[model samples]
Target: MVLLFAALSATTQAQVTATIAQAGFGDLRPSDGFLVQHLQHGPVSIGELADKLGITAQGVSKTVIEMERKGYVTRTASSGDQRRRLVELTSRGWEAIYASRRARAEVNRQLRASLGPGAPAFLDQIHHLAEATGAVTLLTERRLRP
Candidate 1:
């Protein structure tokens, strides 16, 4: 279990670094990528982002402020609720997301190649464990801390 955890951690860190470089988003962190992915679907209110990220509204606001300064995202008053601020990705943010996706795909391809014939079964077992532990839901719904 320790070995598995170490391997996954190392791989994740390397993949994140590679994704950031490939995306030319050195200013963004992995958490930023996760946050922006949510906005890829559509604009979301700050409160909703806080809930989805399992963070405080103030924390989300701080992140939004930084991202806004970087021009990766924009927050505007909601049409229906003037008090609620909706966050959406900018053109640069979309480009970063697309590049990150491509980078991650390449990393997955390399990982599979390294695993060779055992890749499919290994992946299935990993998914099984994740599902059994409810990690799948957590991964999809919230930002995972390393």
Candidate 2:
């Protein structure tokens, strides 16, 4: 019974993630997702994004190069380090990410409404109950593969 529930939850989450990813916010991929996440903290080294995304720096660099061509990101020499470059969103990129976030929020709102007001509290309980076995950890620890 427990395993069945586990499988069901995992399958549901996987499907949800797939659906969200496919939405793609109409871009190549959510490379902007990582950029927006880091940009909140300030500039990030191009190298840092590759590491955080868990892809080869070469892969990340290639994607960034493409995004640069698309004007989704701008790579400028780091103010303090000429040898390094910092990646940042252009105005259009900011617009793109904000649009993506709004899209996700709408999905979340729909989910919450479907689940009812108790859903958030119930989810917290589920997390607590699943703690030692790390069932929910899989959601957070998911390492996307290319």
Candidate 3:
């Protein structure tokens, strides 16, 4: 019975994660939307983005290429290093960023409302997990949407 309950709990958690990822990310892949959100701050090198995202440069380049084709971002030569490519968000990209923020905010609001008095404790637990898992580093670099 205990093992069954544990399995059920894990399944429920996975479902919740998938639902949030689908609703919050919308049309773009989760990683792609995250990259767009990161670019909202300003331009960044592909290498820098890769490092921040904890992904490979080649992976970042592939996504950037797709985003570039979608007219969400532009790639230009870096001022200090012509060899480096800087990715900057376009107006469309900014729109995407805001849209993603709104979606995530709505989900978070609903989650908090459901948790009520437990929200703070729940968030604290999540923060601890993120830190223990090293996700805090990547999360801290991105702005938390209100």
Candidate 4:
């Protein structure tokens, strides 16, 4: 029974992960989308981005490197603090961010359409599950909560 439950749990997690991956824009991961969203407002230091995303500075650096290589972001020396580097999205990055938002919207539309009148309830349950599972940060959970 325990083994069967474990298998089921892994399968469910894989399905959820696949759904999220498919909902993202192009090859951008969720972390990339978060970085792009923050950069859309203004330039931010890698440390600050890491703080907001609750990730390690090294993780942010790796993602920034990938984003820079992809022409989605640029790392420049901060005028205010030469020791620190600021990350700003390029025009391509802005386009990618917008596309990500659209893709997420489309996913939501499809979910709602599929769920029909039960969509809200289904989303509420999902939100609760996410909170319980610590799938997102407390800050993100608060933002998603009513």
Candidate 5:
């Protein structure tokens, strides 16, 4: 179990490193990716982003400010309520997301090639373990800590 945990942690770190390196988005952090992923469906408020990221609104605001400066996101007043601000991805933000997806897809392709015939079963087992351990629920709820 300890070895498995260590391996998972190491794999996750490697994947993140690879994705970030290949993303070509200067200064974009992993946490930023998580924040922006939530906005893929549509624009959301900072409070909503904080809720989804399981972080404080202040923290989300700090990150959002940086992202906005980087031209990845934009915050605008909501049409319904001028007092409320909605956050949405800019074209550059969407490009970053696509680049990260491509990087991950490449990583998965390599893993699948290495696993050969056993890849599907291995992936299924991993999914089963995640579900059994309730990791899937935590992931879906966006409650996992960075």
Candidate 6:
């Protein structure tokens, strides 16, 4: 249970880590803007995005509206399903995501360098353990909630 809790904590912390790192946006904060960038993961409906992120459809819709207002994401009706709206990231949103990812990579490299050596082995071991029990797949969905 301790490991499970730790994993959950780490996941939640990571969700906000990039936002804090990319602070100083005008309208949308780093976290919300970051989500906007990810909005281009194909034509996803509210329920699909909510299911993947463990949020309610209403919450995802609210966020989508905010992203649209910020010009980060655009909403379009699905051709086959008029009732379903899809979210797509704008070019500006892609820029934010690319820049944020680059920044994160730089920070990660610096931290790894400070670790001195054998970090790859350590990371490999962690990945091995993570894969052993489908830990990465346990991304916490509403279906899995109590």
Residue range with the least summed lDDT across 10 consecutive positions in model 4: 137-146
lDDT of 4: 0.72
How close to the true structure is residue 25 of candidate 5, measured as C-alpha lDDT? Answer: 73
Residue range 1-146, candidate 2, lDDT tens digits: 79988686566545545554555535545434554565555667878877777777787778778888877778899878898988887776776666666656666677678889799897787679777667557435443333
Rate residue 131 of model 6 by lDDT: 68
Residue pairs with backbone atoms closer than 3 Å in model 6 (clashes): none
TM-score of each: 0.88, 0.65, 0.65, 0.64, 0.86, 0.67
The true-versus-predicted C-alpha distance at residue 39 of model 2, in Å, is 2.7
**So what's the TM-score on candidate 2?**
0.65
| C-alpha RMSD by candidate, in order | 1.9, 4.9, 5.8, 5.8, 2.0, 5.0
TM-score attained by model 6:
0.67
Candidate 3 off by > 4 Å: 1-26, 124-138, 142-146
Worst 10 residues of 2 by lDDT: 137-146
TM-score of 5: 0.86
**C-alpha lDDT (0 to 100) for residue 24 of candidate 2:** 51
- Residue-level lDDT of model 6, residues 14-65, one tens digit each, is 6545554455334656447434533555667778777766678898899889
- Any idea what lDDT model 6 has? 0.66
Please give me the total number of clashing residue pairs in predicted model 3. Answer: 0
Model 4: per-residue lDDT, tens digit, 1-146? 65975685566444544555564534655546666667867899999988877789998999999999978899999998798999998987877766655655665676589789988897898788767877566545332221
Report the candidate with higher lDDT, 3 versus 6. Answer: 3
CA lDDT of each prediction against the hidden true structure: 0.84, 0.66, 0.74, 0.72, 0.84, 0.66
The deviation in Å at residue 49 for candidate 6 is: 1.7
Model 5 RMSD vs true structure? 2.0
TM-score of 1: 0.88
lDDT of 1 by residue, 32-137 (tens): 8667867988899999988888789999999999999998999999888899999999998888887787777777888799999999999999899989988898
Extract clashing residue pairs from model 3.
none
Model 5: per-residue Cα lDDT over 1-146, one tens digit each: 86987896679657856676666775787667789878889899999988888789999999999999999999999999998889999999998888887777777788789999999998999899999999999888766667
Q: List the residue pairs that clash in candidate 1.
A: none
